[model samples]
Target chain A: MSQHPDSPARSNSGSHCGRVWVIAMHAFTQLVRMKVFYFLAVFAVIAIGSNFFDLPQHTGPEVSGIAVLSSIKSWSLGTMTLFSVVLGIVATALLLPKDVEDRTLYTILAKPVPRVDYLAGKLLGVLLLVFVSLALMDVLMSAVLQIRSSMILNQQMDFAQGRGWSAAEIASLRGDILSQGANASLQGAVFAVFLRASIMASLALLISTFSSSTLFTSIISFLIYFIGHFQADARAIFLESGAAGTGPVTRAISLVVSLVLPDFQLFNVIDAVIEGQAMPLLILAKLTAIGLFYAVFYVIASWFIFAEKEF
Target chain B: MLLAGAVRLPLEASLTGELRAAGLLPAPLAIGTRDHIGQTSSAVALGGLRTLVATFLNLRAYTFFTECRWDDVAGTFDTIVELAPHTIYYWETGAWHQAFNASSYYLNDSNLPSLRRDAAWRASVLNGRAFLERGIRNNPGDPKLNAYLGFLLTDHYKSRAFRDADATFLAASEAYRIAADGRDALPFLRRFQLYALARVPSREAEALALARELYQNRANHTVTMQCVYFSLESHANRSLIDPGSFAVSVFGSAQQAYATLTHYWLRGSEHLPVHGVASALRVLEAQLGIPADKSVFLQHPAQDAEDE
Candidate 1:
């Protein structure tokens, strides 16, 4: 895919895309060598272990025997969410300090690479790692869910048959069981997890740009993460000012918190999906838009801060 | 950073509004629940593992179940369902643990006084019903919740849990009717409707109509359905139809009719009406080989067992 020798891509690597891609690949390789993908093994164990939760079986025909399928998706996706967010935050937080510690920051700055390219490239690399980890975990989850769903489907069909259910009833049972299985909605949910992690990664990048140390960045980023879940509530309080008899200082504080923190709760459609609710593509699109907005704004802010740094 | 926040705040607000309107996001976790979950759990749950936290709570509830801590079981499930209100399994399991397991434990508890045991048993059943009703409200279109409600209302073995038998059956019939709505409803739900409605004295006409409609389907020809159909038909308009013809039509032969009617007659716990069963059984048994010693009247002892 390399350009011809005379082309711009081959000349001095001055093209921003070329430089950024190089850095991103370098950073991706750097993170990958850290053995971060080992978490997928743990994820597989969780996915498989969740399948064994059908204890004290429900004793009626009203519900199918496939509650375990839902349990599998819930546990797997939950693990995926935890793993992805941690990876996104820690990896992004580690990048800048580790680069500086290795003196690669100096060498890279000694080149023609812009600081923005370096930061953006590092963020992209973390994103790529997160995306790849989530994709692997999603594949494992979908596979387990698909297999378990088929087994549950068979069990339900047999149970329905023994109960002499009609074709319509059997079809309904099949649909219910399949809804809890791996489907497009589940894929959309996994993507929502990824989107949440992506936003966290970028936010960590922004924090790391001004942060004194990796530990500080990670801690502050995590604090923001937990607080971000309440950002909407703060926004609501600010929006409905004086309804609760609060004063102006409280309102100002809430407004600042709401305006600053990314609302992490919006990505919680994953919970609904785990509950077997259908996720409309339009809703996923809206969530994607929100994610992109946060990610882009954070990266640009990081660029603005890093652009003038004496390092 | 503040400039970026200023530029994107409205956009974030607008998208958040849209997402909330679309029901793609849940409301913020309440402060009380945050306190209940504590700092570590609050952090993990807010970190996008809310359902995982709910799952752990479910396991904890199960442990409470093993230890026979009924209140703790109930409390953990309350937390679990709050974390995952859309999950039917949590609701169903919670209700089952309360209504069946915990209630049964109370019923047989030798340590408790009789009155206290009875009160605890009743409370457990009621709590389970309330939980299921809450589950149904959260998941309005779920046939499983409706069907489960119907089962609980009309359960023969647990009839003591309900206050008014007639009203309970009527409510059960309604529950089944809702469960049977749409093309995908299980055929048994409609049959269950007929069964429950047939037991309601004031709803005999409506029950007979449903019974007739469901009788047209071959899959609804279970013994209970046939018994309900015969009883409802007799209760609705006994003067219009001959008992023997109806019995033969339903059970295929005189002997089979007698035997099936005898079984239905003896199931005292089921609360089935014997409006036409006895007279029809008499005529059929007289024609069949039932001797004087083994007459249909001899089955009164078993029928009386249902009253006890």
Candidate 2:
């Protein structure tokens, strides 16, 4: 709450963190002021309303009330996630540019707030907003899951009791409806995905800090997102094993290419999560660490560059 | 009789006597064939991935959301990936439908086995192989896909399964390695390094070297957060481990699903063979996780992650 610089009593280490916190809060409030959040809220509501019949047409006799509810819930969360990401990318990219455009940043910079402090504050604001959006969607999804899973369990019991059951029925019915929850890899993957998105956002922020044009930052950031994700595919091609198909130059090129881009593929564990696959915590922690490392790397890089700009 | 089951009118589905009289479509097509959401709102927009093809949703279409159609949808699969390609659930399931959604019972099943067995199989394998090969071109850092492509290759192109298949699989294994290597954290790279070094001429030594370094710089308190189900003891799960969909041999390392098919054909690893037609059924069931018993599958909402 209070920035007490060089406080020997509490350790002078992160006295600046107090300022960062305050700035982050300020940026978040601005996002609300810009009405981007309202736009997202409206989109989320539309997503929920768009679903026609919950049961997929191709499913045939498989249609059940529980299935309809699940599909709708999934659609709603998906829509929310989609809108949030779009908003995040659009909103965060505006960080540097908006300040430059309206001459708002020059005024802010006139105050005691240093450039690093400003950058960190903007990033924190974005990260917090992203977290809140994700959390809101998670709550919505988890609620639907809990309800659907419970209903399924109930219906299964009713079906078994009322119509009677076979040995196969007893075996298939596991207590945990999310059979994938049984696996560690899946759960780890979901966490990794979250962390990965954060890293992507941080990278976007770094680029935004330098570029005064919102269009350039968004385009480059989007390209980076594509390259980062597809980097895995690139390495797979150039580095095909052994001495048989490829030559030394190809291998050299592959090695160089691999190092250049972020491998966003590692963060992909959505299949594992949906399939009820096990996701070990170590996997999640490892991914989180990687994501944080990248995020920090970008932050420091951006700070170094931002500290230099003539404006 | 089938018409009688759902709709009250015997001859009054989408095709009806009027539309068929104009010769627009053949007799007795589902209302979906005529773009009627059948019983729901708008042909339900045929939601769900096309069987084994990975289709992306066009974000640009969001601007023209009302006019978007299956054919008009730009980069539909891109939309899906943009939403969140990391979710294997969405990728795997969406891809399966993209590549294999039996788009036509429209073709005569009676004419299938005898009529076009070799041709169809060849066509399927070629497309599958192409998908993997394309991934090999567009995305090479992804190691899992190479193995997945390898898995598909071994299944489709078993002729290449020579005496030194390990060397070949190693090529495919590179996908996993690059994916691992991309991490700022070295454990991911080291894990694959184990799998890589395992095949080295001097196995024990390579493993020993990698192991010692990894153990010394432990993740400390953050170790517990690594796995999703940190509580679970083992590292692999059936869903995550096998992930047997899109694994036919011909597609080798090529992730032939919605966003990008034939994820890895360049590495050329052996793929698993799920050859039965019922295997298609299994693809629909397991990969999609659509329980044959719809009720259970339906009970679970689709991805609630806001994005996949």
Candidate 3:
């Protein structure tokens, strides 16, 4: 049932890409079932209202397109990312344990599907679902903004040209632009959100494969998320207790931790992205590549540990 | 889809491999301040992207803004404009930050060689030009942005023979026209009329007209309040009669904020006037600690009240 570790290519003739597609579709379907997507759309609407409320409106609050876009990006994208992580983790946790309890894993392993193919499929499913949901929500926000923005431009032109326009008319136009801009911000592929969700889902799957009981997997996965951020702090302690003997001891402890847990903090890019600086492609790629590498390593490690257990 | 390319992560194992190859640090005390950059990094292994790279990017933007590197701040401003084409204040704030704060820094980085002072001044002038350009692009409707842009363009045209003074001044006039012609601008336009009268005396009719509008429009109410408040606060201030107006003006919402705090103060006070006096003095002193000039407003009244 097990493929050799040394070989990169699996002997199974089933296409890895096809299997991944299947997994992604399945994950997307699962996401819809989670009801979190609805939660996100509602939350985004709330964020839009909040942005509207913050406007320095007198006759009415005026907003430019830019303001509307940014508001949507921060409020909607931030909310969506949180939803994705929770959805991904819950989906992975629920699916993994259920498969084991039903002895479904044994039935699947008996087939030609490689362990790598299985792991990749599950993650791909969740990601594709996230993409679809983001696209739909982004479209709705943009359409509303376009109509509102057009009204603003017309009113501003009237005022500027000496064709008398009321202060209310000018303000309403401004408000439209701002509302639209806040909405427009949601159009960017929210890197911080997607990366975070992917890492969390992958980590959850690893926990599921290791723990025999469902309760243990839930507890352990949650702890790993919180503790993973502390990897940098752990290294500080390793250095502080004398770099020779106690240092080596501390270093060993940290290394063991790295080996055992995924570094969740690597996916944190929310603050910089929100401020509107373009993150370099290479830097983002470097982080994602690192994540893919960890995902592969962990899933395979889980497979090895799990294959030995007689379900 | 292309942005997904940014999703790549550097394998931590590469760093791990480097640490294992070189061996350990020699000195024990050296570990306190620093150590082998690679080895200690793994031992206290933070996610490299999360810690080091993100820090560099965030710090770089902050330092440019704080250190008054107008060019760098302008570059960042432009990037932010692109990144958030929808946010109105993002562009306006960026322009203001560059012109007022960041550009001020280029006029001052001590590291510039004495020979580069001429070059630095030229750079500072260039920084102002770039900042105004951003304002023009993002905040075209803003009178302030147009005024700054026109002033900058005119200065460059005259000083360096940049050949754009007419266009720049035209733009400035347009901004002033917007500010002066509008209903909101009426009060401000009156101030200019008054100032012109004080300077040349030929604009007396215009000044009188503006002063009449100030009375009729009642838009000058806030200004009157400010003048009256200062007079009274300064008159009442002393060792026994301190004024809180200066402190409240700093928050700009001092009346409302002090009112809320006074609710708590009222519960415990014996001499209501003394409490008011002490509270006012304490707030004034606290505010004066930083904005020393605000305390200067009290100078005339303090002296006159003492004589009285």
Candidate 4:
């Protein structure tokens, strides 16, 4: 098998890292040209629009403008989750089929390049697209949140001072407003969004290795994505079913489902963060570990299935 | 696949438990709550967009509010809080709608007969109180929710909905105390607690102790505090004390004491205790040499007087 002149394998640099980087960058540029970043405009509109939700529903100055801060976080993070997951799954699903159609896969695989690096590069490219997209959305969210939070803080301060609120009271109010605004936890939540998407992308990559078409891969990945949220519940039923005197068949089914599906509920700390709860660093680190664990396993799994596949 | 799941399942379960312990993951959705949120929202919320679905439902609740659909408004908030239980806004707004908006709507705008209207108003107020209490349970030690509970319990019109005046005041004081105990709570919460405690007949001694502590800070020497302090002190020393002298001792001067007591004496609608206030005023009037017909009591006699 002769390699194409433009292939990374034909170059003098035979390093796996170098080849993966080249392939990943190429994949990133290709996806970027698909205009995936256009979703940021919609996210901007959502983030900016969330400000108007600071409804007059508040009873007093202490709670005023708080609803709007929550609105911003909820809308922004929700949009980011939707965009990242769709981008992760769809972009990864399309890569293999597109490459095969373009004859790029044959050109790359016909050379000395290992299948694992090719697969890793393509997965990394999808992840890079998702990461870059989430980072930009995070920036937009934080900026809008900061500006609105400052306005709310100023308004609340003036009101507190006018009412002769104590210094402690003023500080407490400031703390509440700032908590709802952009902060470290919100960033952790955005990262959690990336983590969840990364899992989906890697899973899609594994599926696409044996998938007959991009449509099948995308559909199956989405079905799994939705079902993954319920994995924890299945585990709970299985674990507790013995004490509750459950039937063996039911217990077996629950156990099978629990062991087979990824428990996406662990990443749902994003909901709590949106509601003004802080995400601790240790938890975020643990979540990062889970994400990497899934991605690495899925990529290796993909490589195994793709290794001997015929063109 | 089974081996992989076996390894990750326990890890995922442990992380879920830890996240929940840290208040980072909300409890699983109850079936009733899921049913209430409907299909699309249930899907959205279950997909980890709970807060976003909550925001959308809140908008729907606003529509329910404008349409004068009070039941729908309350139901919508019930689901909203379930979706985002940690959100103070949802809790606060839910309570406000039931207690203030829905109750007021029943009182003033409902087409029901007067008797049914009154019952609806009272039920709405109680529902609001229940919602706030639930919020307090979900967010234990939260100052704002506790304070809101105190405010609801002490609200003049709403308090009437609660059957027992003494129990209502006692609960209000307890709520206010919790709020006041929180770090960085507003100064006035302590005073409000004192005000509520003073009305609880069995808690007069405790109220007096709190009042004395608050009095040590001169910032708490507002007219209501002075009036409440005087009444509590007078009650404690009822046997040996002369009202005129005690009033002078607490309020600094005959005229000042007389003016403050007279003002407090007339605010009967507020449900503040008036222990020994009438006697103090009678003694002060005699000393001030005000004629019987021209006396403060004769000029504006207490309506629904609560003399002790």
Candidate 5:
């Protein structure tokens, strides 16, 4: 069994990974040159601007410094969600048609590369761009949040000490303030954002495989993104719709849609984490597993449709 | 495609179950709220910016607040908190709007008849309290909301909203105690607990014990704390405690004791037990050479302390 130095199985696996990497890097470079990273500058401005929104007009004594931290997180994460999903879909949607128009698709497909590799490489590329962009935005957000949180903590500490807060009370106040600041949970939230975008990129790739135009792919992907949130509801209804006395035809339709659609709401853990709830590592693992599950399914699905298609 | 779908259906089901059990996903947006937020926002909210939608709703709620649309304010906050249940600010701000601002508006609205205004004001206060209680249920470990609840319940000017003065003070004291139980609760919160406890007629003994514990540290000897300490001791023990000597010892001087005790004496709405306040004031007035007409005795004690 060990006699062969090079086997076709080993060669195929190695070449598949290598080809995917090459195409992925190429896609990354293409998207990067599009000036997509400019959004980080806008994100920087937003992360900084959210610090000054000391709304409610009255910063009462009971108002801890956590409110501003919460705002910073909400605004920054919200912006990241918008940017990542849009980039995921649009970048991925553009990759196939643009490559075909540039004849890169034919040039690559003329080689030994599989369509799965081509699609996966393109998706990985869009994801890489999204991951880098989100990472930069996360850095800006974490830094802004760190500086602002420290300033607020100092002000709160002064206020607490002036009012003769106990050591325990001061410690507790510090804990509460720090909870809303940059931490592991916040990082997890950023990762969750990336996971969501990754799924979107793969879904867009699936759409782009058969889509007539980039606009059609983008529109359909966006529509699916929105509808994906309701997939859970549809699934729930389909599950209970039978027992709940709903018509069989409607239940059958819901079941079909639910089976077809990805449940985007599963990634809404970002909202929970931003609201200061700790996301257990197990939940993140489950989310990542599901994300991978979808990405793999969609990529394979794209390859299925694209495998025998003409230019 | 069919095989992939077959494999994914069960996996997605189990993942959804785990996520739902983990409380990561919120309930679906109500159709009414969806219509209100409009199609674009509904799309964004459903696309995972529920919190951003909530933040925008907060701003809209603020506008409603400024316009004095109390029902709209309440409705918007209801939707906002539902979207971001763990956000303390929305809960607190919403409760405050209902209890204080909305209630105040109802009280002074010239268009409403007096009787209707009274009912509306009472309803607003009750609604605000219910909202805060709901927030507490959502976030039981939060000290600020607990302290806010205590402040709202025990507010002297707002006492007309509650039926039972003593029971209300007891509830307030309990809320303050819970807030103070948090390791980060300010030192004043501990004394604030004693203040609320002092007003509870049946809790004087417990309040006295806490006051004594706080009094050991010279730093806890604020004027109110001193007055509460003197009042609780007098209320607990009928004899052997000379009010003047106790006040002087707590306040550190005869003139300061008189001034502080006299101020405490006049705050009738505060519900702090008069306890030895009057007796201490009488002795202080005699020693200070104050005229009988200027004495604290002639000043009408607040009915709050007497009612308890």
Candidate 6:
């Protein structure tokens, strides 16, 4: 097979990083051309529309705009989660089969490219797509939230001034509104969304390595995604079940299930952020470590299986 | 995969516990909540769209609110809070629906017998209080929820729903105290706490100290706060100060003291303590040469007269 002039495999200074970048960018362009970014438009609408959910509040002026702020974060982050996960799984599940069907995998393997680099590149591509999409969504969410929160603060200040609210009261109200606005915690939540999607993408890559078809990979990935949310609960039952008189058989099964499934519940700190809780950097760092751990393990596992497979 | 899972399982478990302790992760969904949210919502909620499901249910609860389906409103909010227990909006809205909207609905429904209507109204108020108390439990030290509980306890009409006045005022004071302790709590919350505490006869000494502390800040010298402070002070030092002289010193003049004390005295439905108010009003009135028939004491308390 003839190598393209721009191919990393043909470069004079051949490096794994260069080859992975080339393949990852190729995958990104391929997926982008599939018009996956179009979902960002839908996300824009959802984020902007969430602002209008300013339901007639029953509380005093102190909490006037809070529900709307929560609404915006909930709708925005929720849409990001859904879109990123779907894009991560579907885009990844499609990549391997599409490459095979196009005979591109054969051509790539025919080159000096390592299979692990190729797998890493492809997973990185899906992750890049998910990260970019979430970043864009986060920007839109932050913009809408900032503007709405400012408007709310102005209205609340006017009301407070009219009612002769003290300086401390006014400051307190402003602090409350701003806490729910565009803040570092909200950014951390968007990053958490990206991390969760990255895990899904890499996991889907692993599933697709041995999966018979795209449909099989997608279905299995989704099932595992849902079941992964419950893995922590199963683990808990196993850990604490000794005194609860759970039979040995039950404990053993729970242990096996817990040991085999990814614990997706660890990423659910996003919910608390939506409720205006602060996300400590330490926690986000821990979550990042977990995400990297999962992705790296799944990708290596995929390579182990793919390394021996006959294409 | 097993080895990887085994290695990460402890880390994951520890992280899970930490996240939960930090209020970053909610408790696992209860089985009944799963049934309540139904198949699709439960699936969505479990799929990491818990807050999204909660937002949708909030809309649904609004519909139930419009149709006067109080039970449906309550049930839907039950599921909403279960999904997003950390969101104070859902908790406050749920409590409002029960205490204010549902109670008022039953209050004015003339078709039912008065006894049944009264029972339903009182039950709705109690349910609202229970819901707010549950919210406080879930979000301990949350200023908004605590303030809300305090407001519900001190509401003119709703306070009647509580069977024990002293315990009700004590609880309200405690709630306001917690609320005032919050970092962003309004300064008024502290004064409100003092107001609630002063109404609790057993807590008058503590309330007096708080009132003095609050009064040192002139911003807290609202008419209600001043009146509450004066009454609490008199209760704390009943034998130490002359009612008329102390009243004048607090209010700056006998006429001003009489005017402030009269207003406070007439708001009997608020359940505020009177202490030296009536005696001070009498001395002020006598000194001002007010006629017997025109005396403030002869005028019935406004809310008491309305009740009669």
What digit string (tens of lDDT, one per residue) describes model 4 on residues B21-117? 8888889989999999888888888888999998888888888888889899889888888889988878888899899988998899557999999
User: Which one wins on DockQ?
Assistant: 6
Q: How do all models score by TM-score? A: 0.91, 0.49, 0.44, 0.94, 0.88, 0.95
Number of the candidate with higher TM-score, 3 or 5 = 5
Which residue ranges in model 4 land beyond 4 Å of their true spot? A1-14, A52-62, B299-308
Q: For each of the candidates, what fraction of the native contacts does it recover? A: 0.51, 0.00, 0.04, 0.77, 0.55, 0.73
For the second chain of model 4, what is the TM-score against the true structure's chain B?
0.93
Alpha-carbon DockQ of candidate 5: 0.49
| Tens digits of per-residue lDDT for model 3, B48-110 | 121222222223555676555556665655544443332335545565564445444544657
lDDT of 4 by residue, A1-311 (tens): 23344565555645677778778999999999988788778887877777665564535656678778887788888899988999999999999999999999998887677889899999999999999899888898899989999999999999999998778778888888888888898999999999999999999999999999999999999999989888889899998997989899989999999988788989899999998887889999999999999999999889899997999
- What is the Å distance of residue B288 in model 3 from its true position? 48
Choose 1 or 6, whichever is better by DockQ. 6
Worst 10 residues of 1 chain B by lDDT: B299-308
Docking class of 4: medium
Question: What TM-score does model 6 achieve against the real structure?
Answer: 0.95
lDDT (10s digit) by residue, model 2, range B268-306:
232211112122233535555554565222333222221
**What's model 6's lDDT at B212?**
87
Ranking by DockQ: 6, 4, 5, 1, 3, 2
lDDT winner between candidates 4 and 5: 4
| Weakest ten-residue segment in model 5 chain A by summed lDDT | A1-10
Q: Report the candidate with higher DockQ, 1 versus 2.
A: 1
Model 4 steric clash pairs: none
Which stretches in model 3 have alpha-carbon errors above 4 Å?
A: A1-16, A23-69, A101-103, A110-112, A140-189, A213-215, A230-266, B1-308
